[model samples]
Target: MRTVIRRTAVAVTAASLALLVTACGSDKPDAKKEAPAGDKGAQSSAPAAKALSTAELEKLLVEQADVPDYTVKADAKAKPVAAAGSAKADKAACQPFADAIGGTIATPAGQAVRMAVLTPKDSGKKQSPEEKALAGLNALKSPATRVLLGSYEGDGASEALNTVKNSGAECMSGFTVTQDGETTKITAATPMTLAAGEEATSWSFTMDMGGGDEAKFNLGLMRQGNTLASFYTFSLGGSVEELPIKVIDAQEKKLA
Candidate 1:
């Protein structure tokens, strides 16, 4: 059991928690279509938005100082989708949503920054030994929250946000995504209400990890100008019914 836990933990951290999910829900006919590349009218008339470079994004991403109770660090494993089509959705229309959960932007971004925010092992003071032990267990049950900040030029940020929204609406009940040969099954996807930045959207997912083991994964997105921020929460050995508001709030402030 411990070995399995360790392996699953690594995969979850590796954008494999960055994500690959499956769902049992039947297909819905409401999938949305994007404008054709050749359609000039499809393009926006507003002046192009300036995207923050990778270096700029790195500085803008949430830091340890901003989240005092959590350990925030760069995520070495979170990278762009593989060129070999390693991360793909079972339903073509759901690809954008899948990509968002896997630590990448749906619409292409000029650059992105990824980070992992680990929950504190204990909160408050004056804990008895038993209390400390229980706190440790609680901490173990709470998985790291992965954050991604993506910047785009032109209207890519809007495109990215729309793509994710449409996909979530289409596949809210379930879907499957495979990353590097392993599959992540999302048994349910529940929409969330959030107010931040220029626009925001979020979802809570029930991840079926097979063998009767399951994990709670909550995902949220917010866009400020040409930048979009994504917060991904994954919990194992237990359940999580809420999104990481603190992480979202911190990133939203930085982007603002």
Candidate 2:
């Protein structure tokens, strides 16, 4: 009877060992399996963050500035939608301005600035060429800011400066301009100016990016009734980029 009991105990021990080995082998595959349904919700809701694109930033800035409806041209006889006052600043404006300035060139990683403008709505029957130009500034729906990569020196310097200054740019000295590179930068919270009376009460400035890339750009902000406009221009390495300025509110600037 004692011998019979010992044999039975040995047989039981062998069976237990085999079961344990099988359990361990099965666990390896299960460990590699995907997570259960319980975890799916958490992963789907949290996506990686992304930086804002240039177009996005421009749009954001326009919203902040509160731009109004504007027309481009000096002919007062032209109506806002008819002659000189026609041509709303829209997404279509981006490609044309970009094309005019050779938008294919590379801009530095952080070389963006904001500017705005405000002017009374053209209530007159006729719009002038300058009025149409100003209107062109307002039609842009994006952050029409451009990075000045380079510009030709010599004869074009004064011409470029005058062209910019005439557009309500406030001159900033102490900034450098270099050959074959970027030189200066400007930033703003609103439009620059319009007809002296609309000049911005806020402050704007220029900074050097170091090396041969010396350049200058004017940031502007202003209010035309409830409307606002932002614009800028820069000279770099013999090239100039005139960024489109946009009116955010779409309301026409009216005279008081």
Candidate 3:
């Protein structure tokens, strides 16, 4: 993923360099100011092209393959949470976090899916609150190496679905959760990468869930202004809810 990002960066740099060269060449009025007699016939058609209607221009833009469009997730939800407080309260406060499940849902696609998230404790007994939270999560029995957070890009609905498909979990089971008088079945799991402000990459995994319903979930966490917020989208038409979140910890014993 880092390699993908590096390549993109290099491409942008190259494009900018080309643009700079073009600008520098334009500064020299003596350089090829007049077109050749054979090219004059082609220049006559330029004004007609510029006279195209707005709709025509839009159609042309759509037909262009190289034109990039920022994929927008339709009815996408973006929830934000803070990163302060005790671990238990923080964990229990957010159902999504507690459930540790999220992903896109399509018709005939919604089903029973269970997910879990885990991280290493490192080598600290009285670890930081964040560390304790991660350790407690690690203690839970699940796929040992599949822990992560993820970010989805492009069309909102598909992006969410892709987030789940890429989560590296077997089939996603739609967990039934009640919210606002309606029982909403949603994908539960942790995120691959925690995106604070800037865009991040999506996470993927490949593992088998032995009869026991256990899978580490990735949580999208970031500090919003002064408070922390977690990202979430319930459905394609759902609005993003920025919920206040925190990380708390209880006194934990040292691991041998």
Candidate 4:
């Protein structure tokens, strides 16, 4: 599983860093300024790409109408928070991934639209007493999903996606992150297969919180033209075996 958020969905208490494993887009000072490899020739003669503003990002983000069954909040309205780039990985090579999952990018000027999504706790249908009692165990595999829609300039978006791809692949063994004096240990990182956008890479991780508390989380990155979409999901019911397909599909459609 991966780290993202809890689907208990609507209410977030303190914005724990342990469940944040989603947003990772940047335009860091050191990144090269060029066009994406696939479109270099065409973009070379085009004007430099401009990032979408916060207002534009909001319009592009999902609204309750888009996902009527769940709760969605974008930008500053999204709460129980963690900032991207606030976490540091013990291995320098894995820092990009750390910042990625932490919900912030490593670059200073990268523009992004952030959101929090939660699935319904109740299935909306009347449940038998037995079903209600078993609900605790049969609850949504992933209750909360954290999202990032990052827009880039030049090749910044592609560069960000590649950085995440290389690092998520290379750091599968495990690593630790330190944010605001809190430490999170990742016991495992498992890659996943996915089809979406122009290109995508995915992973699920096991996190140990001591006291024998372990949770599985899923993290995925999808590239859509000059933008990057990152989804991180977590579960309190048990292993989050699947990504939030409904949420992802809706967001991707909005991006398209």
Best candidate according to lDDT: 1
CA lDDT for candidate 1? 0.61
lDDT per residue as tens, model 2, 1-256 = 1121111111122222222221111111101112233111111122323333434333333332243322211222211111111211123312212111222111211112232222223333255777655433332221223211112123222232233333323233221222123222322212232221122221123334445443333333222221122333332222222223233212123111
Compose the digit string of candidate 3's lDDT tens values, residues 199-221.
22222211122343332222333
Model 4, position 193: C-alpha lDDT score? 63
Could you tell me the lDDT of residue 251 within candidate 4?
78
Looking at model 1, residue 131 earns an lDDT score of 71
Range of the 10 consecutive residues with the lowest summed lDDT in candidate 2: 24-33
Question: Would you list the rank order by TM-score, best first?
Answer: 1, 4, 2, 3
TM-score of each: 0.72, 0.21, 0.20, 0.71
Candidate 4 lDDT for residue 44: 29
Alpha-carbon runs more than 4 Å astray in model 1 = 1-46, 75-85, 107-109, 114-118, 121-138
lDDT values, one for every candidate: 0.61, 0.25, 0.23, 0.59
Candidate 1 lDDT trough over 10 residues, lowest sum = 21-30
**Position 1, candidate 2: lDDT:** 11
Tens-place lDDT digits, model 1, residues 49-122 = 77777778888888877765455656566444332134577888778766676656644444555544345434
Which portions of model 2 miss their true places by more than 4 Å? Answer: 1-49, 55-66, 69-117, 120-173, 179-256
